[model samples]
Target: MDITIEHLARARLITTEDREIPVSATLRYTTCDPLAVYVDFPAEAALDGEEVTWTFARSLLDQGLRAPAGHGDVQIWPCGRTRTVVEFHSPYGLALLQFQASALRRFLVCTYGVVGSGQEDMAAVVERGLSALFGGV
Candidate 1:
């Protein structure tokens, strides 16, 4: 059966003027999307007044905990000793949020509990994809 790890983490949104706006974000990991991690933001935090979710490589999150990782629209890096910063870019603008490093580490550990690194059953994932593409033939 597929398993999921869901976490709610408090974040500080970094504004251009150097102000911090407290926001709540949802972190999600699931066997169904084994290669990716998802972070969801509420409508209040969006420029278009709608909830937004960004998906990026799961490895990026793990690497970012040690150093900077990712490129393009999403980037993650360590912030000081107790925090992490994840930045998202879009046509509207950029959202930079700081999260507790401990919280992120806990979440990452939980994900590993469900699916160990390099242990993903890619054949199953591809089978599902082909099933969807061909309607299980």
Candidate 2:
């Protein structure tokens, strides 16, 4: 699996496995900052990023799209009051990082999570969730 960032209409598209799983994404909001970052992964994949014991989730295989678990891993930070929804799976899990649009900064502050059952709809879920979270835009 590979990950790359590309310019999409007004947001950045983050993808893996030839775009099969969108994972997470960042969108420029005010020319200088991103509007939001979206992430979705599997249960095992999600758990793997919680500690260095396993690098399967944030492994070099998929670039830096995933986070290696740690107490203060910059990749996965506690964003004030954002609600992180983790969808559990027998073999893996799905997570949704929902946060404020104004929180997006120049640096990559968003964390990666596992994608569960409906991963194909991750982009839409992230888009809608962000829109709802920020109230239009």
Candidate 3:
């Protein structure tokens, strides 16, 4: 239920007029090693439907393995990584957990590729992941 992080990562975010539109991105971070990053599409809107919620979670875990880093605003070779789950109560508005290719595959196989939760938990996951990946102020 509680996730704490104390590492500095490279990241940037921007909001557009479209609320429902999913934000695509590629991110990389160092966790013990130069961890390759992958994530699902951005999970926008409050997750109310079970199917939709799971969809976003699965996407994130699924893509965690592959490296999706880039040098521009838009991804060059876009890959569906992981959807961000936000935890406002903790700190950051949301957290985007980047799954490495091996980690993604391993998690999917080990966990049966299930991701997501109610808005509250989703937010918690997001916040925790963000804090871990990026430095929290």
Candidate 4:
């Protein structure tokens, strides 16, 4: 059975001037795609005025809580003791978001309960990945 877990987290956008803008995101995880985590940003937060969903490795967010992780389009790092920063890059520009560490930890805990990191059924995951790849063709 596929299990889905969702958590609502309050995050702050760190602008170039170092100003913080508040935003809320829906953090989602599911056994259907166990290796990835999705962050859904509301339409108001997007330049195109449409909801945005950023997908990245689940392990990246987990490692980032302790130290810096990721590169390229997404970068996540610890921002002191109680906050974590997740940066997104795109053709449009950049987005730097700061989120409460506790909220992220809580959300990860929920995911672990559902899929238990490192315990995912990779055979199934890979098969599904391949299907999604060629099926869309």
Candidate 5:
């Protein structure tokens, strides 16, 4: 299934620690052979408005979500069915992002070919390889 993001009603970034930072942000998913994910921040006195774009890759989706063990600048993990946990270590904070998992899966499939049933057994090997490449999970 080719999942395309039409529009996001609303999205917010929450902090796990004490911080007075604004968490309002907009998300837009563009349709393409390889989907493009964009997160835009409105202009504010603190920030002059910024937009970040992440290009999906086949290998990334196969690896799934991950977080740096011990301490790290950023952490990412899957939460529940439709939520994702993103933690930023800068100034110590975290954000709970709510998105459609179906859309995510579609984006993954579009970016990277579907994972075959035969590849299921290699999940552990892939994880171990990624962990080693990433300096341990």
Candidate 6:
């Protein structure tokens, strides 16, 4: 599996101390290690003058992304009808991220390819990913 970019969006990183920074970024993952995902933002996107990459362990992210409805330090779930929300909590601060459904669908297709149940439509792939993350919502 190759390192694939699944989605890119205009995002805002919100810190626990109430600091928010705008960014253009993408999410990437590989089949060789589906448990890990990478969030990559360019050097210019960094406020501290360094390129930033965050590797999310499957266990931690799975816990955060599937945090039992309304519980946990990190929470990820659908928002409205066409968006997903990801919130991270830490002793130092919090980070909130959101992405569009259409973009996510494209990312899934690009990363996983249009096959299996998703061959019919790219949205199906996104739906599958969301289901896995939210436990069928």
Candidate lDDT (C-alpha), each: 0.92, 0.30, 0.31, 0.93, 0.42, 0.58
lDDT of 6: 0.58
Per-model TM values vs. the true structure: 0.92, 0.17, 0.21, 0.96, 0.39, 0.53
**Candidate order, lDDT descending:** 4, 1, 6, 5, 3, 2
Best by lDDT: 4
Model 6 worst lDDT window (10 residues):
113-122
Q: Backbone clashes in each candidate structure, one number apiece? A: 0, 14, 15, 0, 0, 2
Could you give candidate 4's per-residue lDDT for residues 35-72 as a string of tens digits? 99999999988889999999999999999999999999
Query: Global lDDT for candidate 3?
Result: 0.31
Residue-wise C-alpha lDDT for candidate 1, range 1-137, written one tens digit per residue: 88888999999999999999999999999998798899999999888889999999889999999999989998999999999999999888898999999999999999988998998889988988899999884
lDDT of 5 at 6: 35
Query: What is the per-residue lDDT of model 2 for residues 35-133, given as tens digits with 9 covering 90 to 100?
Result: 233333334333466421112222221222232222321233333453221222233433324333233322232222222222334466478678889
Candidate 3 to truth, TM: 0.21
* Shift of residue 48 alpha carbon in model 6, Å: 3.6
Candidate 4 weakest ten by summed lDDT: 128-137
Higher-TM-score candidate among 4 and 5? 4
Model 4 gets an lDDT of 0.93
Candidate 2 residue spans exceeding 4 A from truth: 1-49, 52-91, 108-137
Q: Give candidate 6 regions above 4 Å deviation.
A: 1-3, 14-21, 44-47, 57-74, 114-137
In candidate 1 the C-alpha lDDT for residue 23 amounts to 95
Instruction: Write the residue-wise lDDT of candidate 3 on 29-104 in tens digits.
Output: 2221111222323344323322111122333433423433332222222235533222111132332332223333
Off by over 4 Å in 4: none
All-Cα superposition RMSD per candidate: 1.8, 16.6, 15.3, 1.3, 9.5, 10.1
